[model samples]
Target: MTTEKETLNYGPVLFHYDLFPEKIERHGKVKKVITKRGTFALKEAEMSEDERNWFTHVIQRLSEIGFHQVVPLYPTKFGDYTVQLGPKTYYLMPWFASDERNERAKDEVLLDHLGKVHALTLKEQDFSNEVVEHSYQYLMNRWENRQFEMERFTEEAEQKTYMSPFELTYLSHFHQIMRMTEEAKRRLRDWYDTCQREKRYRSVLCHGKVSRNHLIFNPSGEGHLLNFEKAVLDTPVRDLAVYFRRAAHQRDWSIEEGKALLDLYEKHVPLLNEERGLLISYLSYPEPVFNAVDLYCSKRTQYSQIELVHRLESRIRAMKKIRDFCDAIMIAPPPSMDENAPKNIHIHDEEDHI
Candidate 1:
């Protein structure tokens, strides 16, 4: 629990402490803060100068668009973002109204809200140098390093645990997944290179992380976006891909559902055929991302073995859903039409028609 003085120094809002086990984050601090102004999510993390600029730029831009997705309690001196406190920066945001629960939402409502967000233009948003280059470089570097880590981890796991059938099978799966991920990374790089070659590598300010959990609905059912930490200037299609991947995690989803969501997005920001293909191709990497996360979580000192296993299982499940989605798209054949064909229109008749 943060002391009164600590909370006072952190921001304008003083919060009511909740002693519950902090279910949302088992290993981290979770406090319910209250103040004369409003409540805010007080999180602590070590960030770099580049990351600081990224958040600053994103918050300033989102606020400018009147999106109301994320409200900075303490905005920057230029009224763009918040100030850093000590080595740990704190964000004073609106204490969401009581209505923002974790329950599932109907697909229609969710899709509509997402469409509205994607509709917002980034031209009016605040941005800075190094934002795009830093973010892109970070992702590319992670992809390269992560592949190496996965290969080494799989090898070690195989050498140590192959006595068990489950271990051997898992190692095999891990190796296969790593190779697929490497391919995805290569494709993504190619897409980036193509964009540069065509002089179409312009950055669009984006929410970076898009999901229902980051949304808050007001009394009138108006939805608000949140979680701007990952916001950075990169490919807009990458943002769309992240949303699609997350939406794919929901139940009652079909090809039509995905199409409807994408169609709605197209209304706001049209995507070229090639851009759409790039987004589709990028979907292949989530499984590898989860596998990397699984490896990292196992080494995290904060989590117990049970907690680690639970987190790994959830990520694996999400990855599996993404994999199944990829499979469905891959196995699809070109559309065929012969609804009014005559009875004699068999394989032999098809040759004659051609």
Candidate 2:
């Protein structure tokens, strides 16, 4: 980190207490501001007026709902959440102390906070049937293309007189990849049918990027979600899918651990029947197979044969774990929603202020 002479001019900001900047430390696009008042984080990003407003509204709403896991943005004297200095925009938030939680503990905190966020943002609405059907068709078409590409790679590899080590490895696992793809398609079809029959879907403002990097844990072992630039209105399972995939991959495809994490999340926000089906379908998608195919067919060879083989093997192992987990959960009946009802379903209509 490099020290910067130009500290954040906080005099113009509507701070609750007096603030005196002691030093400014720069780390890429973020700045750590140490002040007599307290330490805070300053981030610079390009955000439109609407985007800024949306972020401000989300933070304020979360705060209003008593969800302290989200760090609120400090507003400027002009009552704007973001401070604009020419073309660049900046925002300030409190710097939370890092927690000393183990890997599994960290995941638990993340899912717990995520469940709270989903519960607060969840809304019951009737999604357009056409839109849902179109999404399902799009996913199915993409999966079909992936299957075709895998087959093409297998055929081409068979024709090659000298097969590379990576090619051999991929060929060996091709059958398993195809099996997973077929199972994924079947699950997706089931999910689509369920959605169509239900005609109602639950929507929540998902923290689009749910990764360890974006999750900030405090000393008390509570995790706060950071970076809302990519946040969007989607199903809660979107976050769960991203999290579960990474967690399972990191732990080398441990189904027991993955299910335990899901159970932790369920304790906060129950997964509905449709939600469970959607999660299983999303997890069933052969992401690693698609990645392997993309890398093999790329114009430039970026990785060695050994590295490629290792990557593919790791992916196959993780995918198998995910597949087994999905199969087990799909067969097991979804837990009762009443067991995980939201503590406060009523959201106050507070005026937006950040």
Candidate 3:
């Protein structure tokens, strides 16, 4: 199926690289370009001009700052890191094949690299009252709106004479879920109060989407991260929260395993008390379970009743795991930073970093 016509479809973008594809295999959004020279991953992404420029800048800046664990992007003959055609943007990198043997080590590598990225660019930003107030109020308003919607859903289900299995499952856990929501809101308030009192906050270069899938192992067995499309300068907790939330959904994931991983990460960059609270708040919100309910309500015909019920149950189980993890977090502080960390921490400005 790898014909000349198929390769030609991407020729306009490949022309800049001067590569003649012998074959191209589509893997998700990336095309595996098999040429006489070598195999490469040609990634197709949607990025505005600003996002494309910023993405290329983040990859390069990570290298310039001595954090080169990221996958190295290949440049074209014209020395451009990315190419554009119509509404799509394309970039190229060496095709690093996946290794199943290293699968178990993924979370460790992901968090470790994330910690390095955060520590290298960590900055204690001068507090801005206007900025802090706006951020806090925006998030609080959003959370309250979602809570009200869930309450309305519960009331509607209760009024029904005979509820569906999905409704029954939701009703059973409704009280526990609400408790978790309140806990998340309380923690968010604590974070906001601490920031206001201390007049301080920290920002770092965060891999906005932190997941095991974004990490790939090279032939040498070292893990190199890819997909920095959503990279940004923000609080370090943003990445940690994102990582832990996703991890909680896995069947083998445990509170002990989660805490051990957090300890490994804190060895590189220890989390402050407020940041820890923020991470807990982010994890406690049962948004995933709420999303399952929304999907059942909006698209029940698309999927079977049993499928929807199973999905809701799966999310509820994950929420329980997250609740326990939050409890363990409150018991102790993050482990100490590694002694080898530099005495002078690098403070990266948003404009300067990306």
The prediction achieving the highest lDDT against the true structure is 3
For model 3, the local distance difference test gives: 0.90
lDDT string, candidate 1, 103-214, tens digits? 4453444444444444454231233335435655777788778767666766676677333333344454565566557656766666666555554433355667777666
Judged by lDDT relative to the true structure, which candidate is superior, 1 or 2?
A: 2
lDDT of 2 at 105: 68
- List TM-score per model, in order: 0.63, 0.82, 0.96
**CA deviation > 4 Å runs, candidate 2:** 1-29, 35-37, 44-49, 83-89, 102-104, 336-354
What pairs collide in candidate 1? 14-34, 15-33, 15-34, 73-92, 75-81, 76-81
Q: What is the C-alpha lDDT of each candidate?
A: 0.53, 0.74, 0.90
TM-score-wise, the better of 1 and 3 is 3
Stretches off by above 4 angstroms in model 3 are 340-354
Deviation from native of the Cα of residue 9 in model 2, angstroms: 14
Quick one: ranking by lDDT, best first?
3, 2, 1
Q: How many backbone clashes does candidate 2 have?
A: 0
Model 2: colliding residue pairs: none
Deviation of model 1 at 203, angstroms: 2.7
Candidate 1 error regions (>4 Å): 1-31, 36-57, 66-83, 100-103, 106-119, 122-145, 160-166, 172-179, 182-186, 189-193, 246-259, 286-317, 327-354
Q: lDDT tens digits, residues 156-268, model 2?
A: 99999999888888888888888877877887888788888878777777888888767776656567788786677787889999887776678454777777778777766
